[model samples]
Target: MKRDPDFPLVRNLVITLFATNGHLIDMGNRLVRPAGLTTAWWQVMGALGYAPAPLTVAQIARNMGLTRQGVQRVVDLLAARGYVALEPNPHHQRARLVALTAHGRAALEAAEGAAAAVDQRIIERIGTERLATALAVLGEMRDLILEELAQSATPSNDPTLSIENEE
Candidate 1:
């Protein structure tokens, strides 16, 4: 079989990225689960660790680029496991804020050691310096492209006008 040169290259790129990320998460989860954690848990922990301030589901979702419901489920599980605490949101009385509990902090600390092991393995598999540079470049490009797409997709001042991708 022959393939067209312009055969939806973007689709192939998206699939490759997702598959690689899923495998990486699998490795992380392997390291975390033994310490009573999941890949989802790490996402929340990383966000809170990045900024200790309590964040609402919506806020964390935006920051993590995940759906609000997706984060809510993770928060619910974390709370049930006593790894996280649910607090009233000061900014929005109706919204609940998610914060890491003492247990969560301890768990995260333990997980960090495991994370280092995973990091070392990955670095050895893929050159440490090369992977670091590739990750930075990919992140920057993803952000820039998303920003451009968002801007272009926004409705124009004129009614009944909006830019979009056409097949």
Candidate 2:
């Protein structure tokens, strides 16, 4: 079968995006580590902090585009450390609401300050305009990818989706 002429360009873009994501995650981990947070922990905490009210583990997972079990693990860890508190959910009997405690809020604020410093450094190196353009392009790419996924009938585990052709 003949491949689309644009396939190579798309493939290269995907590879670059993956590499960039890794670098960004590494930077995030470094920035938040001093605050006693990993990138995943920071992300979950940020989501809860920004929300109007507390959220269940499943709700936080959905907001962060992660698995419930993954979010649950982090929530449990945070709870154990007194960074977050689990409250009885009026809406659900089993799923408790998770809220940031004073300690969690303080940690998140510290992490945000550290992140802001990193952002300033990056902005100085890249310029705000270029960074804005890059963000816009990334958002467009994400939307296009979502659209493609919505339209695609191919099974996620299909061998044809693999980088290397399978026999």
Candidate 3:
């Protein structure tokens, strides 16, 4: 079948995005390793740190755009390691609030300090203006992809509604 000219560009972008994601995750793992945290653990901790208050596993999942089950597993592990504590939620009977322990906060700060040097190196290589532009473009692309996903989830009457096949 004949493909649109833009297909190659989009395909390359998707491949590059995945490759970049893998590299970033690997870097994150290395940076957080000294703090006894994995990339996943750091991500959960970061979400909690950014939140105004302690959040439930489900809330963390939503904030991180991940699944509740996956977030819950990470929370359980963190809680076991004393990095976080689970307290009864007054609003929800079953959904307990997850809060970072003092140890967790300290570890997170250490990890951030360790990561700052690496981040500075990256910024110096890329330049602040270029990095800002890249960030904006990535944010826009993410929003567009999310909108497409939402549209795809809704039932439609047209059979040829798939964006992939659109001209």
Candidate 4:
């Protein structure tokens, strides 16, 4: 396959993104540890906290770009700890809506507080404009990747969509 001229740069970007994700998750785990929450648990709780209403496991998974099974496991653990409550979904009979309890809100707030200093430090070092630009670029890249994923998942007659073609 003839590689794109920017392939190397794109490869480096992807590698950096993967490494950064790992580092961020590690940092999040450390920050949230005092609240008795792992990074995964914190993420799930954050999703619930940000939502306008309680969400089903499947809905949370979709919003977080996670597998439903994985979110289900986290939700189960959260519920067992009394951090979250699962109520019947009005729309779906089986998929229960997961809502953060008062305890869960406190835990999430603690995690956010712990991370606030780190976030401020990062912003101070990186500058708000640069961070904003980076965020926009990352959002664009994510959208493009999602488009590719959706296209690949669907049956297509277009030859350009073949694996042998350059991305």
Candidate that scores best on TM-score: 4
Candidate 2 runs further than 4 Å off = 1-4, 143-167
Evaluate model 2: give its TM-score. Answer: 0.75
- Taking all chains together, each candidate's TM-score versus the true structure is 0.75, 0.75, 0.81, 0.88
Candidate 3 per-residue C-alpha lDDT over 1-167 given as tens digits, one digit per residue, 9 for 90 to 100: 99997899888988999999899889999999998999999999999887899998878886677877798899999999999999999977777899999999988888898799999998999999999998898889889987886677643654434553222
Runs in model 1 lying further than 4 Å from the true structure: 1-13, 124-128, 152-167
- Per-residue alpha-carbon lDDT of model 2 for 1-167, expressed as tens digits? 99999899888989998898799889989999999999888998999999999999978976676777798899999999998999999977787899999999999999999999878888999999999998898889878876785578355655444533211
Tens digit per residue, CA lDDT, model 1, 1-167: 79788778767767988999999789879988988999888888778767769888777877888877798899899899998898987667666788898999888887888889767777999997899897897798689876985677646553323322110
lDDT of each: 0.80, 0.86, 0.86, 0.89
For each predicted model, how many residue pairs clash, with residues at least 3 apart or on different chains? 0, 0, 0, 0
TM-score ranking from best to worst? Answer: 4, 3, 2, 1
What's the candidate order when arranged by decreasing lDDT?
A: 4, 2, 3, 1
Q: Which ten residues in a row have the lowest lDDT in candidate 4?
A: 158-167
Error of 2 at 7 (Å): 3.3
Cα deviation of 57 in candidate 3 (Å)? Answer: 1.5
Cα-lDDT of candidate 2? 0.86
Clashing pairs in 2: none
Clashes of 4: 0
How far residue 105's Cα lies from its native spot in candidate 2, in Å, is 0.8
